[model samples]
Target: MSTLSRVSNTMPTSLSCIDLTVTGALDAATVLGIRQESAKAATDGPILVLLDVAAVTTVGASGVVGLLEVLHLLRARGGDLRLFGSSAALEITRLQAHLGQVTRIYGTREEAVDGGLGPGRARHLAPGFRWHRLFPRRRRTLGWS
Candidate 1:
């Protein structure tokens, strides 16, 4: 079985920023760890998983699928995953293997981090702050068939 390990730098305080350096095969086990780590970071603020795929020259279909699951899970939990330092050969292989669609591609770590974690912008759509257009229902659909 393959493994996905991360060494990260983050603010100790809750509601801050996190930067994780992902390495290895990035399989299901790795995906679970990443999800847990990201969720923990989200309690403070956005999390960034900076995947350094330079060493990972090849990835299997399961690995790619796991990555896609991780991306969507992080997004749903208000965190993100980004790729950095991937080789051209890897890029071509990723495309040829039809795994590119599963993950967002970025040229630089800075760009990925900047794009995912918004620099200094407030989270406007937080819980308990409902939009004016989405009105509350008068009658609740409680256990209706």
Candidate 2:
């Protein structure tokens, strides 16, 4: 006689892509990696930096702040960083909503890779992929600061 045992587990997929992983902590090093990879992609044109934050057990304020900086840097350089499989989208959204135009959030890696930010359009490694701002800038006391 034999008895059957049921098992349940969660594991990340071993998918090969232009992807990066961050866990436990996100800091200057993470930003550096993003910069290096983005610079390389700038040369190639239309670089997609997919960060898998699904396993991020604890994302501190500083870490989230660093992530914002990295995202801004990529956008400034004509590249982009998209959050893939982010289980903590709520936290990220809250932290970045105030910053205005932070990282472009996506539900899946496929959506991010497909560049599905706009309506019924697919952007890839092609020309004319300019980063469009979702909101207009507001004039501040420093005169559009």
Candidate 3:
């Protein structure tokens, strides 16, 4: 028997913090649940998402694939996804290595959020790409202070 737990909390910056606890097998059903929860949490367009997988005991290949898909969807919408905790987990480390620079892993939730895990963060952007070009109307439309 396996267990999957998901809890989501919204941050001050509208970043959704999802804490996932996976014990035993992680299947496609669990992944779907996670995706649905994330979608519910992000109702106002693209937004930064922080995943806390510290309590995950194991990750299956399908789970990894699902996570990658989620990451891609978020990034394509001008948003970003960051993973925190589980640094010592072999599955997480392997996934991080496989994903290379595409994935950002943090040691703590605060570090992940405070480290500029959102849009308009100069550090997160690629070289030669300006924030205005990516989000010209975000500040005006979103009233981002």
Candidate 4:
């Protein structure tokens, strides 16, 4: 497994951009490192986390779940997490399909940062809010009804 490196930059009071470049395989250890980096980047005030994952070569299910967890953490702290990478990245595309409403994805870092930092772009949900709450209930078919 290859290592993941994260570099963070704090923008004037409202945004903290984290560039994560991961090479080789993205495994549990690399995902943990990313979570730690995200925690370190979070602040007391409302902040946006723009993650640049353009350099990541391979990603696993664990990596995706880890990122979703990070996103939840940031949202709970009155912030949001946005991912930017090549549109061809299968892992990223899959994630976008599943969590697009809760998380934003962009094709380029500039686009991600711009969208993430834009006025009224970040959806600040209440702390401890669950993503499932955003969706309406589906009618029971057979078992639970």
Ranking by lDDT: 4, 3, 1, 2
lDDT winner between candidates 2 and 4: 4
Error of 4 at 6 (Å): 2.9
Model 4 over residues 57-134: C-alpha lDDT tens digits? 776778777877887887888777777775345455454446555565576666566764566666444234576777
Under the 3 Å rule for N, CA and C atoms, how many clashes does model 1 have? 1
Residues 56-118, model 2: lDDT tens digits: 555456656777776777667666777756656435544444532344456576676655645
- Which regions of candidate 1 are displaced past 4 Å? 1-16, 43-45, 88-90, 97-99, 116-145
Tens-digit lDDT string for candidate 1 (24-114): 5555665666667766666765555666665564455666677777678767766667776766645765676555544545565655555
**Model 1, CA-based lDDT:** 0.59
Residue 39, candidate 3: C-alpha displacement in angstroms: 2.1
Alpha-carbon local distance difference test for all models: 0.59, 0.54, 0.62, 0.65
Error of 4 at 117 (Å): 8.3
Please count the clashing residue pairs in each candidate, in the order shown.
1, 0, 0, 0
Report the C-alpha displacement of residue 65, candidate 4, in angstroms: 1.1
Off by over 4 Å in 3: 1-11, 14-24, 90-97, 116-145
Which residue pairs of candidate 3 clash? none
The candidate, 1 or 3, that scores higher on lDDT is 3
- Model 1 pairs whose backbones collide: 15-44
Q: Which 10 consecutive residues of model 4 have the lowest summed lDDT?
A: 120-129
Listed in order, each prediction's TM-score against the native is: 0.56, 0.54, 0.62, 0.64
**Candidate achieving the largest lDDT:** 4
